[model samples]
Target chain A: MNPILKRLGFRPDDRVVIIHADDLGMCQATIPAVAELFDAGLVSSAATMVPCAWFPAVAAYARATPSADIGVHATLTSEWDAYRWGPLSTRDPASGLLDDEGYFHRTTPAVQERARPDAVAAELHDQINRALAHGIDVTHLDSHMGSAFAPHFLPAYLAAAAHARVPPLVPRLSEERMRAVGMPEEMIAFARNIVPQLEAQGVVMVDHLIGMPLDRHEDRVETAKQLLGSLAPGLTYVIIHPAIDTPELRAIAGDWRARVADYQAFCSAELRAWVQDQGIHVIGWRPIRDVLRGA
Target chain B: MNPILKRLGFRPDDRVVIIHADDLGMCQATIPAVAELFDAGLVSSAATMVPCAWFPAVAAYARATPSADIGVHATLTSEWDAYRWGPLSTRDPASGLLDDEGYFHRTTPAVQERARPDAVAAELHDQINRALAHGIDVTHLDSHMGSAFAPHFLPAYLAAAAHARVPPLVPRLSEERMRAVGMPEEMIAFARNIVPQLEAQGVVMVDHLIGMPLDRHEDRVETAKQLLGSLAPGLTYVIIHPAIDTPELRAIAGDWRARVADYQAFCSAELRAWVQDQGIHVIGWRPIRDVLRGA
Candidate 1:
């Protein structure tokens, strides 16, 4: 049994789920939709990208609603062309995180290949510290585009979460667990070996992670229903990007409609009803953080 | 004879004018209006607020149009309630430039009371270097909200400009000039003695300066026509804040219509024709830099 979940006092067979929205402060579209889902108690948690243009809005909300189960979505990539942001810390420009254009590179592979581990650590520390300073009682931590999932970044990522006394969304891995998801053999072996080292440091991770396949789906409602119905009996994080389609979002993101669809699906009353009908126990990161850090 | 204008090979009675647009990158509204005036050759030069949201747009334009006379508007004020920005250098938060809300103070008095002179110099240096790194052949430096005009900041302001080999917008002050303008007795006395010390350092200063009343005017065309006609027979800077009256600007600034009026006046064919008729030889800071730096 997972120690973090055991501390939360959930049995091994009990089905617990965290409907988590990603990219809370990326643009004009994301925050409002996430707020709506959060308000309705449909999505119990969200991760905020603090360096984006809409961060002040999230900070405003965080200040107003201090108990919101918001995590720092530690960002390294500026992915979109028209909408780009730079690092928060001007303390270190030689951090290898910035390209020649002085913006962060748009890909995880580039971050892995080009960025120094200490620089990566510095940026991550800056992001988390920025949120905490913004008055966010950050419940957990996660990565944008899996940038921290790279082997080189894993230690820094884990250390940052530990330093902040927050749970990270790095799942407890095993060969069976990785192979169950059809991960590459080498990665499965690597992740399996690394999981225990992280677990030993009192890191909190979901028992199983799900809902990535439902992303950018042709039929979001149907896919969302399928995702909700198929929730296995254990703690799982079902990730989604919820955003209302606005002209600003359209200009900023190419996948604006996908975001709109995700927003619609998550905000759907049917999805809420289906969770209850399926007897799935919905949870947030607050309890997990309490269990991990309090221990 | 005007010493600075004389350095530029202008006669004593040349009546040189720089139709200088202020706040080129302060918001979404300002850029397009400034760009149009620059394109039509109505405005000879424009200062850019590097901390503002629209800076990247102007930087892109400066890159594409290499000959544009872009000067960094050394900003210490974030003025408006809704639209706010902070410093470029994160190295010194203890510098006291940031207000309680983490934005720059909205007034020069606040800056004088709070900001460290060294930090002001660092911020100004960083802004210019950021522009240069963005491929802007930055022509000069100027202060936003006259922040650098405070007696406490004047030395750092001039030092930064001199260090960059770029001229600042400090006019050479004299008692007669100060008394003529109805300035305070104390300031006039201080400025009378200080001007010669600055001139001794080979610091380039404008012989005459105008452009205060035209802001927020109901009839900008009439005001502009009058301003050009009354220009002294020396180098003078006519500052204006031009912007298309967009909803964002309307929401951000109460003086949006005045900005629109400014945009209209500078882009107006009648104004351009009037300047030509008045024999005001319109020039930019590029020539001033040429004379001042001899580079």
Candidate 2:
């Protein structure tokens, strides 16, 4: 059981949760949809990618809705081919973070290959400070494409969350503990080396997380119900990419249908009623952030 | 001799010239290089592609520079593969103006094949009006990739110039007249039917032109000097695309060096002295625009 949730006055066994949507500022079409979800309380929170084309709109929303639970999805990768973005931090000309066309490389591996930790730290700070400059009192700090999870970026990631005094998107279990809790040993072993120092930063890591094996969600609503039904003791986080299906979205991302499914499953009245009936406590990053701030 | 130039108060045999740099707002790097030419009184006029990525800077420049001669490069083609632009006018989902990928087609023939004249006109008005709305007092209008030279588009091209009460970038000679001035027979014959109607609009056109066989200019300065030396006794429109050579420009356009050469030749003191020594009166679209407005 997570001690952090108990420390925040939740029962040791309470299934505290945060349903977060990623990539709010990726495109114009996602704005209204996410805003509607935020208005209806269909989702717990969302993070914005500051380097995206539609970021100003999201930033304006953050200013307008000061209480909205928003974070900078600290971006260091530019994924799409025709539609691309570059790094916020100026890396060396030889930095592996940038691609041949002078855009950030698309994947975690590409970024990890040449991304200096100091450069990564600078970019993370840039993104966070940009949100702050735009009057966004960001609720928490998270990673984009899980780039922060890379071994090279782990210290910077933990340091950033500590620096910001906000809860990070790290899972509750340590790498060895994650293996004990059924996370693949291959994944956990790499993280095991950094676990002690990351824990030493006094960051609040989540107890359990269930959004992995994204391929398991062939029937997203069914999967959501099962995941909700099987929630373990203490806090768990579900990281989802929720977006309305539009022509532009389909053209932009190959896995866009999954995003639409996330929106549908999360926003559905059925899902809401199911969560309520199952006695699940719907929460957000705000309380977790407050606790981290106090810590 | 240019009767239009004479009507506009120029001498009958005056070799009036407009050193016009097209695509002023095509990129961020081109602005400074083009502005330097304008400040040096090397380029008499420049035109901006309002549909381009860097239009706002050029628009801001136009607002700040009331005396600067700038015009709209009405565009309907999305030429470059990686760096493409879309039409201002959002047509119906089935509008032929849009390619399968939901952008403007890549060439004039593609636009001509499926383009509705009304759609073309709407897009032209949108581009022109966007410049106006951005506070650009457009001095003239011209084709991009010579899309207006296509037979189907010529009417809308001429009508837009008249509608805007601005000079259209057509040579003073008709296709047949171009041949009489030593242009190719086929080129003149292709333009014969519409030439008279285009002329009847009372729109200002250049008496003769240079910048032909743009591929022929390996030594751009030599080309410019010879073209100025052999200028016929009438207005000559020297159409050139100028840019500063950078990695971005090189990646975007293969003929970047030629564009840089155009910038170099036009901005050189030698070319200014050459034009002055030969007594070619430097003019711009403003006087012609006034002539059209008065007519």
Candidate 3:
């Protein structure tokens, strides 16, 4: 029996998974696609980019639909070439959360190299606060582009989640696996120390995290099916970025085809039937939020 | 005697001017600059770009300061190279509100050639409605890059303002002057006929519209002083784009120096004293809104 499943009151053999969408408020295309997935009950959870231009639309949707399992996608990077957003806390040149162009750094490496820990902490809190202020009953917190997963920012991220009383999307990876994924030795050391502490404090950490290859653009439905078949027992988190095919999406994302494919794959009856046949016990962050809140 | 002055209970000879800031919510730079101007009572009114990424900050400011004279800057163009925004109503490629890159057309000419009239109307209404939804108590509407002032869009623009019961920033330009500024014959003909109708409906139009030369990067204070010295007795509208000097502003605007100069010019004690000496009666859009609302 997986201890997380036991904690969540699941049976010994239960295979719980969270089919989650990423970047729900990134653009107009994302909103409709996420809404469709939620309405169809295909995706169990999603997160929003608090700093994006289309975020107000997400806030409005959250206000109208209180049951949607939405979280704050703690954004620390603005990667698009023609569309950019900056830190909500401060735009000072010395803030260290900003690149030379005054937007968030475009890549995780740039963020890891340049972002000051205090600024990172402040920005993460601001993102969560802004989401809450906009009436989102935020269920969890997750990092965009994995920027907050860097060792220097991990403490701030955890503190922010603790402050907000929401479970963070933390995966229980071994130190070796973390290193294989390019996590620094500092992060591995910190994770080794903090994982158990968080688990002791009743934060739910997934047994595994899975995502599709970013370069795979074709046969996404087949890819998704294969991924589902390969899922192991215990709790797992699957992250998918799905967006409707629109000019705006194409303009902002070079991986528009892959995103569109994800949207189609998740929304298709074929995939839904496959998941049911696989007997995956789909769950959302609500239970984790409840646990964190001592409900 | 200026009929607008009589309507507003001002003497005919009073040199009423609106020292207005354009692009209030366009970025962080604009917000603080506009706030400082408003706090110091240098600028009389400012308009917000509802589609811009930083617009929620403006809404927050408006909510905190109920007396702030804020209006919707009906945005139909996203002109910057690295920072762009799209129409609020739709992101459909075929909607004709988007350019090849899926943003609002970068220039007024591009918008005029590409945007559908119905799409333009819907987007303008959506922008205003979005601002109102954000609790703006919107006082007026004006065109960004004058996209809404084009002949084909004029009817929709006026209709949006009428629907919202807020005055649209319409200037009383002579037919020859409009032609001189490259207004198409159709626009001149349309303005000639519609201006009278709008006035008869109690819509106030400024007698003269003045903006500093776009190319003037230096001596902005001197230029502003000279412009103030040349003000006519009839109601004149002075438009300024003021932004704090920051890396973000520099990245988004080619005329950042001029914008910063405008901020400095307006915030200067010298300029404030000069305006006082000139006895220019500064006004904002709130009174116009009241009149349009039959208050």
- Predicted candidate 1 versus true structure: per-residue lDDT over A1-295, tens digit per residue: 7665567777877788898999998865677788888887789999998766567678778788876899999898888754466666553566778766556788877777888899888788878987888788999899998888888888888888888898889875556767886666867777878777766766666777775443364788788778777766667888888887664566557777788888888788887888788888888999888766565
lDDT of 2 at A152: 71
Instruction: Identify the superior model by lDDT, candidate 2 or candidate 3.
Output: 3
**lDDT, candidates in the order shown:** 0.79, 0.73, 0.84
Number of the predicted model whose TM-score against the real structure is largest: 1
Chain A: TM-score in each model: 0.92, 0.89, 0.95
**Residue-by-residue lDDT tens digits, candidate 3, B1-295:** 6566778888877888999999997866788899899988879999999878677678888988999999999999988754567776665566688876456788999998888999899889878987888788899999999999887898899999989988899999988789888888988888899888878877778898888766676988899989988988888889999988765566557889889999988999889888998899898999878865775
Candidate 1 chain B lowest-lDDT run of ten? B208-217
Candidate 1: C-alpha RMSD to true structure equals: 5.0
RMSD after Cα superposition, model 2: 20.0
Give the per-residue lDDT digits (tens) of candidate 1, residues B1-295.
7677776788877999888999887876777788888888889989998876557778888888877898989899888753456777753568898876566788877887899988888888878887888778888889887778777788888888777888888786556877886666866777878888887877666776777363466778898888788877887888888888764566467878788888988898988988898888999999889876663
DockQ of each: 0.18, 0.03, 0.04
Cα-based lDDT at residue A123, candidate 1: 80
Model 3 clash tally?
Answer: 0
Question: By TM-score, is 1 or 3 better?
Answer: 1
The window of 10 residues in a row where model 3 chain B has the poorest summed lDDT is: B82-91
